[model samples]
Target: MKEQSRRLGEDSIGSLMARLSIPAFIGMFVMGMYNIVDTIFVSYGVGPNGVAALSIAFPVQMILMAMAAMFGIGGASIISRSLGAGEQKTANTVFHQVIWLVIFSSLLIAILTFIFIDPLITMFGAPAEIHQMTKEFLEIILLGAVFQSFGMGMNNIVRSEGNAKTAMLTMIISAVINMILNPIFIMGLDMGVRGSALATLIAQAIGAAWLLFYFLSGKSTLSLKGFGLRIDVKLGLRIIAIGFPSFIMMASGSVVTIAVNWMLQIYGGTMAIAAFGVANRIASFAIMPINGVTQGMQPIVGFNYGSKQFGRVSHSVKLGMLVATILSLIAFAVAEIFPAELARIFSSDPVLIAESEEALRIMLLAAPTIGFQIVCGGLYQALGKARISFIISLMRQIICLVPLLLILPNFFGLSGVWYAFPIADFLAFSVCVVILSTTWRKVFRETEMVR
Candidate 1:
């Protein structure tokens, strides 16, 4: 098992991808399932409004996740390279400092959220019924914000330190807790939406504690050694810089979700909102396997780029693209074929199932391209091209997307809002092709210089 982690740098490109992607797929698949399980329970136990309320809360949840990705992806990129260069001490310092960042940030967010939960809910365009549900769920989950914040932020560090299995274990174990507690609390105790939120918070708290204990233990290679509470400005800056891409990517998602929910409320009503929620959740599962592939490739890309193995880095990029495209095509078919079954899995509510099928079919029209966009953007981050990744992220959500989201719905009404996603994704993939062409030119240039 230890031997698997050891060959990151020495392995052939094909072998490296397989070794990294398999664990990443399982871990990330489980990560997606974490919410999916909740969506099912909420849909069954609480009904379509419950699912809609959960959907409304997603943008806020994403905001916290954005912060985690900032520190997690940013710091991990540097740490992987540092480890590859045999600078274990520096890696340890970065890890400890990251822990401080995650805790402090979560505390600040929780205070602000608690102060204005109602106002924030209104801003997200929640109707009276959905607003009540959203408020209850957000309040419970926000109380334990630090657990999720630090857990997700630190999980990447464990993986970068050659502990992918441990990093994966964090989610796997949490998934179990979430799975068991959801049924007991929701049905056995009759807690409804609040019960679902409570179950998630409890599970995430355990994950956070697990990540913290692992670094403190002697068994880990990157133990936190008395890293002073003071933040190092230089280290902090680099972490932020490397992490900017991931922050932008997740932040854009939050923005898109808010925009969609607001529009659905304005033009489509509660039924439309429910439909959007189900369709989006299904799309999330489809896109994530490809994300897993990119995630596994990130450390490899960083390690090779750090070691100046330019050819190896290029090979990994191509491999990611191929895997992502193939997987996306397959998932597209599955979602399209089983739309009713998928909707039914989440909710038996007749109105939501009828309407959600519209949203699902519309959004998935260009689903195969999720593979192209994910692979393109993921490679940019893996190669330490943060700005490129940020722009690619924006292209789908902000630049091409928000405009179409606003304009299209006005002309075509409710269906128009859902249609905008696939259009924006297709356009972004074209731009990605151009950017990647330019990026490859630079890669070979640097490779020649090293030679």
Candidate 2:
């Protein structure tokens, strides 16, 4: 673990990125497949209604992920920097507190979700026809909130300690398990939507167990010792403060999804809603590499910044941005050129494929520019500049996307919903450039002063 941590500071930027990101990319890429797998299986087994139910359920899942990211990303940032600064004790404490926090948050979310399942599904625009299925699916999934939150949140912590492979393995293990189980439960057992949810729940449990064993085995730089389930007010606040940006990013995504679903339901009905679901999943798959790259860059930037290696930090961000932009461009090309083909991967219904293809093209029109914005926001988060990160995150999802979703659909009708995506992407990308430029100067200037 010590050697792994040291490599983050000493390795060549390019090699380190490759070493870290390939595994991270594979992990995230597979993790993204988890959703795609479910979509495909459910769509085939239970039809478009199953897809719609999952779509409605997406926002709630996003909220769960947002909470996990708060502790995971937040705790990882502190731990990586603490390790860089040689504050082993601080890193350990944050790691331990993160575990307890995840448990508490997950339990709370499960209870709330159970209590409010009806309203939640209704708010997500689930038609009366699919409400029962959506509710059943979410109820089963929410029951495993502890596993989901702990597994995901701790994966980042594992990477922070320089165990990127282990972190990658955690996601891969869950995804693979879910992949194998989804068909059996959904098709073989004829369990339908509920089966898909069960597969995911079981997979998360195994992943969470995997993480627990690692930490307990004492192979990690940080362990669950001396600070078991004990929360220091100051440390807890710092963790939340640092992770707030990540939370906002994901939570805002949930909100935007709900708004989108409502708009689609109002204008287009079930077909529209299901079409948007297909497009959204494809978009998510396209963005996974960006997520992986950003995840890889996070520990590198946080560690080097803590150690005051401003040059390496700058180099890492630049490389990350370049790689991300290229990946986004590739995604844009694929979406533009083969939208229908891609949509067919999820469903065979002519209406579904045609509508999804159109939505995919229109929504992703400005996707080529998204790489810069995503990388820029992640840079701020890695440097512990949560305010800037939060703002950047907010701009793309809530501030820009939601309003566009509201106003554009009013004018263009269902097509306007598609327009909202690119319009928001373009506007948010411009704002990101401005903020990132200003932040870049301030960050480097502070480094010079310290030097």
Q: Which candidate is the best by lDDT?
A: 2
Tell me each candidate's RMSD, in Å, in order: 1.9, 1.1
Please list the residue runs of candidate 1 whose C-alpha ends up more than 4 Å from where it truly belongs after superposition.
1-6, 447-451
lDDT of candidate 2 at residue 46, scale 0 to 100: 97
- Candidate 2's clash total is 0
As for candidate 1, its clashing pairs are none
Native RMSD of candidate 1 (Å): 1.9
For model 2 the local lDDT of residue 309 reads 87
Over 1-451, each residue of candidate 2 has an lDDT whose tens digit, in order, gives: 4889999999999998998888999998998898898899999999999999999999888888999999999999999999999999889888888888888998998899899889989988898999999998998999899999999899999888778899999999999999999999999999999999999999999999999999889888886777655778898898999899889999998999899999999999988999989999999999999988999999999999999888889899999999999999999999999999999999999999999999999999999998898888888888998888889989989999999999998899999999999999999999998897776878777668321
* Tens-place lDDT digits, model 1, residues 1-451: 1343346678898877776777778877887787788888888888888888988888778888888888988888888787777777787888887888888888888889889999998888788888988999999999888898888898887767556777778888888899899999987899998999899899999988888788778656677677778799898888887788788888888888888988999898887887888888888988878987887788888877777777777788889888998998888888788888888877877888888877887788787888878877767776667788888888888898888988998999888898898898889888988987777677557557432
Candidate 2 has a TM-score of: 0.98
Model 1 lDDT at residue 141: 90
